[model samples]
Target: MNRLSTNIFRRSDALKSKPDTSAKQPFRVRTGFLILILSASISLANAEPQNQKNEILAELNAAATRVETVKASLQVGIPHPTAALVQWTEALVAYRKNPEFLYLKGYQPLVPLYFLLKSDSDAFSLFVPRVYKVFRGKNKIFDTSIDIDIALIPQDIILALKPLRINDTDHTEWKLAKDQTAFELTVKDKEGKILRKIIIDSSEHVRYQVEYNDAGFPYLEIWKDDWRDTGSIFFPYEIKMKRSLPKKNELVLKFKEIRPNEKLEEKLFQDTFPKDAEVVELKESSG
Candidate 1:
């Protein structure tokens, strides 16, 4: 009888040593389910910010596409470092999208100027009637005396006046203001150099922008205000540009009239240099 009891006790101990797989199976399943939930939560957290950024970009792109042709009459306030008072000049400006062209005619009593840019061909023409001089060049025009640089190029000018189309390859980062009134966006190149920074208001209007040079230096800063709903889009009646680096100057443009999507004649963008004016052709540098 004692021997029989000892064998029975050994059998019971063996049963206890065996694992309770039925309970462990449920625990394993619950752990896996929890991991799945955690993974989904992380995925959603990552997607939300990207979705918001895409929405903001879509709004800006839509507004830009609404503007095909623009014609405006504006008064420009030009400030000189040596002058005590700001010089104001009236100007007529025309811009065409797609092929991208810009024409500007400034009326000043002493020095009338005309500038035309054809981005498709990468050509530019500048005519100064008072001096009887015409400069035709390819790429950029750099003349410190006239205060003309890459900022005057059609691309840069349009970027200042309108919202830029951010590409997929561009590295973009955005943050909401502490007050939650506006969004600040910084765009960088593939190599992580900043290209531009913009501040957009709640109404999706770009209130301010600072454009950087290839070396990642801020060369131009622009502010747009006095926004008005023009049925098709929001337009800014007043724009200011502060230039730095190569020169320090301020240009304020107040639009008297703006016509968007106007049917403009092709000749308006053509360079019309007088036959009597001396033409200077600038060639590209070889290195």
Candidate 2:
């Protein structure tokens, strides 16, 4: 016999004393029972961890629901490492309802600029008075989809509380920092690649910092500080964002006042352009 036929005959010979076909039903039934027991054991093992995760999430959601809105007057500074010039501007920042609306009006020396981040549309609009230009798109003044500006405009405790992916924790990993001062949560993609990391202090029960990769070699770092109680929730009054694109530049925000749950007008969120403004619709990139 050929090698393939000989190998098959050897396997058949090894099973020559197999249980009688008439009694094979018992063996099949027993094998199936064992599989069912193993499946149940694995399912129970998974359910317990899921329940623990849900409890932790519930506590965070409760704390985040306290604040409905936040408005602040911001003094922003942008420093240039290569040059001695440190540009400064003032802006009025307002955000309402998580993942809803964000508004900003920058009072630049040359001309005032207005920006609106509308999460419902997954886009942002910028109105420049100097050139009377209105620019709107996914990739403009700031990235739209990831909604990173949410970390800046309102910079609320809700952000730390919001879970990125609730249904699947397969790619989510969290642990206490080595120093034991803060807890860090790392989110990954399906391919097991790291997406971002969120770090919060358990003692303060608030997010202290966030680190993530941007369009640069070194990672981006954001720090929240100058916290004050607003009756409903404790919020950060000042935020510092630093980036290294071969050279380092930083954006510092100092809030003079922050009013939580403040009432704002509907017209404030509209994207009404000036009569002389040139509207620019950014073309979708092929990439």
lDDT of each: 0.70, 0.56
For model 1 the TM-score comes to: 0.70
lDDT digits (tens) for residues 1-287 of candidate 2: 26645654565555556655525654555576668768876665444334344555555456567667777787766666568766677887766675466676678665555333333235666665656676665432232222122223222222322222323543667666555456566666677666666665653444544444444233455677766776776667766676543224467777887777888778776656676768776553334
Off by over 4 Å in 1: 1-52, 108-120, 143-155, 178-180, 282-287
Tens digits of per-residue lDDT for model 1 on 1-287? Answer: 46645755565555555576544554555576668768875665444355567788998888888888888898777666677777777888887776777777778666556443344456677776656767677644432234233334444556556546777788888876544567788999899999999888887788888988877789888899998876677789998888785556577778998888888887885556688888877654443
Poorest 10 consecutive residues by lDDT, candidate 1: 142-151
Maximum-TM-score candidate: 1
Worst 10 residues of 2 by lDDT: 147-156
